[model samples]
Target: MKTYIHNFIAYKELLKELVQRDIRIKYRRSFLGMLWSVLNPLGMMIIMTLVFSHVFRAGIDNFPVYLMCGQVIFNFFNEATTMAMQSILGNAPLIRKVYLPKYLFPMSKVCSCFVNLLTSCIALALVVVVTRTPLTWKLVLFVFPILYVFLFSLGIGILLSAVVVTFRDLQHLYGVIITGLTYLTPIFYPIEILPGWVKTLVEMNPLTSFVEMFRDAVLYGVVPGMELHIRCIAACVVALVLGIWSFIKQQDTFILKV
Candidate 1:
């Protein structure tokens, strides 16, 4: 851990460059540019609110606000994970030419997503205020959940960069998998809406706590469930360990594979 941290600190310039490259290239040819990032999620949330709130007759009051909270967070994860999948192979030139820390590629995208997520936070705060949601000091509890998000993203990004470099098809396969994972997640509905047995499975998913934690802080102003909190922490630790192990094991072969 110390070595990885030290390596990251040493290669901080590469990280910043990568982050800037992502922000620039992401919308470089587009008309709306970065606004599209803010709008896509917002537009999806609006459609969802119209469909789910009115059509499905979801019992969730303030479904717009509730759903937006989940959408914003999910978008962050989606962007981070998708970008991380290509982090290594996309930078093959740098990988071949440079001697910096290899992990910096994916972590840089995570940092870029971090900036995007911060912008979404401002959008989320506006939603909360416009919708007249209650506020309390408990909102400070968001720190813990956001930290988990960053760690969780780091863990997954590092692991995927290693795998995707070798199995290129994973780049396409993950898109399908993430689509399924999105619906399987309770971003649009409450846990109560799910079957009891299904809730057990959902609770086991680390994203469950992250989503719930967001809602708790932004909507209800309460702490997350203890059981889910424990599960979330455990999941993050396991994932982080696996990611680091995989990176260390597979990185030696990256040049040959790429």
Candidate 2:
């Protein structure tokens, strides 16, 4: 762990360049650039709000805010892990010639998506202002959930980056998993509408804890309970420990594989 930390500090500048490269690649040839980050989730929120709030009648107050909260958290996880999964393969040429820590590649991807996450939160703030939702001191506590989700995503990204190098088929499999995960997460609808068993399953999802904690802070103006803090911390710890362990164990073989 000390060695890892030392290497990370030593190569911090390389990480910065990798993160900048990702942000540039993401916006390359795009007319709107970073504005799309703000607009994409906002647009999705508007469409879903129309369908669920009007058509299906989700019956939730400030549904746009509620929906955007989930989008901001879940979308970051999706983007971070997807990009990180490709980090090793995508930078194969560099990895071959360089002696830098392989973990930096996926770490940079997560950092880049974090920039997008912040911009998406701007969109969420706009919806809150437009909808006249009351802002409370609890809104400041939104940082806690964001931090929790960031760590969780980073751990998952690191784990996937290592595993995907060995099992290239995981790239395709993960897409299907992500699609299923989206519906399993209560983004557009309330959990109350689901049956008891389904509710328990949904609640079991780690993302559910992150999403609900975010909503409690930003949308509902409530500090997340102790249970949420415990769950989020546990998830973060387990993911990071497993991810780092796997990466360290397999990194020496990455050059041959990639």
Candidate 3:
């Protein structure tokens, strides 16, 4: 573990380069460029707010802010993990020639996505201000959920980066899983609208806890309960530990597979 830490620190510059490259590649040739990160969520929020706010009658105060919070959290996790799944195979030429720590590739992807997450938060803040959502000291606590979700996504990304190198089909299958997860996450809808069993399943989702914690701070203006804090921390730790363990165990064989 010490060696791994040493190598990661040693290659920190390379990681920064990779992260910058990702951000550049993402916006390259796009007319809107990075602004899309901010606009995309705001646009989606407008559309969903019109549709669900009336159709579902979500009844929550500041529905747009509620919706934006969920979108920002879930979108970060989705984008980070999806991009990380391709980190290994996408850089196969470099991997075949280089001696860099393989984990850095996926780590860089997650870091780049985090940059977008911050921009999306700007959109959320704009909506909060526009809708006149009350700002409270609890807004500071919003950072906790973001940090928890970042760690959780990093773990999932690392694990996927390793596994997808060999099971290339997983790249497609993961899209389906993400779509299913989106609906199960209560992004635009309230959990109370779900059937009891369905609500239980959604609550069990780690993303659910993170989303709720974020809403508690940013949308509802309440501090997240201790139970939520513990749940988010536990989920982040478990996912990260499992991701790192799997990556280490399988890294040796990656050369052969990739």
Candidates sorted on lDDT, descending: 2, 3, 1
lDDT of 1 by residue, 121-230 (tens): 77677777878988999888877777787788889988999999888899889999889778767888878877888888877778878888878887888878897678
Tell me the lDDT of model 1 at 73.
71
Which TM-score value belongs to model 2? Answer: 0.98
lDDT, model 1, position 80: 89
User: For residues 1-258, what per-residue lDDT tens digits would candidate 2 score against the true structure?
Assistant: 799899999999999999999999999999999999999998999888877787446468888898889999999999999999999999999999979899999999999999999999999999999999999999999999899999999999999999999999999999999998898898888888899999999998899999999999998898788989999999999999999999999999999999
Compute each candidate's TM-score over C-alphas: 0.93, 0.98, 0.98
- What is residue 3's positional error in candidate 3, in angstroms? 0.5
Per-residue lDDT value at 107 in model 2: 98
**94-190 in candidate 3: lDDT tens per residue?**
8788777999999999999999999999999899989999898889998999999999999999999998977889988998999999999988888
Name the lDDT of candidate 1.
0.82
Q: Model 2 segments beyond 4 Å from truth?
A: 55-58
Ranking by TM-score: 3, 2, 1
Alpha carbon lDDT of residue 212, candidate 2? 96
Off by more than 4 A, model 3: none
Error of 2 at 130 (Å): 0.4
